[model samples]
Every structure is written in C-alpha cells, then in structure tokens.
Target: MTAAFTVRVQDEIAEKLDRIAALSDRSRANLAAQAIEDYVAREEWQLAEIQAGIDEADRGEFASANELASVVAKYVKAARQA
Candidate 1:
C-alpha cells in the first residue's frame, strides 16, 4: 500500500534533486521518497536511543567521575597525538 502527499521545496533544492534524478536515471519522486525514508529512519533511531538513555538515568545508571575522567583523558590524549 502507498499514500500520496504534497511537499514544497525551495527552487534550488528542487533543481538539485532533478539533476541527481537525471544523472541516476531515477524519477524525482523515487529519490525524494528514498531520502525521506532514510531521514525518518535516522530520526526514529535517534529518538529511541535518547529515550533509552533517559530511562537508564531514571534508574540511576550513570558514569562515575572516574569513568568520565577516563573517557575525557582518552579523548584528550588522542587529540594531542593528532
């Protein structure tokens, strides 16, 4: 099953999409649908992860000071090396 809806885009973006569609030999609708699907999936996954972190915090699951410092130190060391 499929549903149809309308969306508006800026002229520049529409032009870019058209170019990509032509180059890839795909319809603008197909490319737009795929882009929307990927965006929605990423947002859903991010929201789920955020909620899981909040649930963990509600149960008092958090990194200790030592653990936090260790992570910071590791990153700082890596940055210095870079």
Candidate 2:
C-alpha cells in the first residue's frame, strides 16, 4: 500500500521528467517516486558515512601522512592516465 502526495516542480524539470518518463515507458509519478527513493537512499548512505568519519575523528583515529600521500598519488596517477 502507498499514500499519495502532491508536489510542485519547475516547468523545465517537469518537462524533462515527462520526456524521460515517455522514453522509459513509465508514468511520471512512478519515475518521480523512484527518483525520490534513489535520492533518499544515496543521501542516507552519505550521511551515515559522514557521521562515522566524525565519530572516528572524535576517537582520535586518523590516517598517517604517508597513507594520505599514497592515496593522493594513486588518484593523481589514474587522472594522468585519463
């Protein structure tokens, strides 16, 4: 079972949503609900990870400077390849 609610979106965003819905052969409401669900899940995960990091910091747990440089160097190497 599900509950219904009303929402207002900007014209451009609504149009884009409509276009995607039509292309995907889905109702606008279904697409909107799915997008909302996905967004909420992603945000919840991000917030939890942030809180965990804060707790770690509070506990005085941190990476060594060499560990940080190693991570940064890996990214820099991958970026240069790209």
Give candidate 1 regions above 4 Å deviation: none
Which candidate number maximizes lDDT? Answer: 1
**TM-score of every prediction relative to native:** 0.95, 0.81
lDDT of 1 by residue, 1-82 (tens): 9989998999999999999999999999999999999999999999999999999999999999999999999999999999
Q: For residues 1-82, write the lDDT of model 2, one tens digit per residue.
A: 9989998999999999999999999999999999889999999999999999999999999999999999999999999999
Ten-residue stretch with the least lDDT total in model 2: 1-10
**Model 2, CA-based lDDT:** 0.97
Model 1 lDDT on a 0 to 1 scale: 0.99
Deviation (Å) of 66 in candidate 1 = 1.1
Question: How accurate locally, in lDDT, is each candidate?
Answer: 0.99, 0.97
Best by TM-score: 1
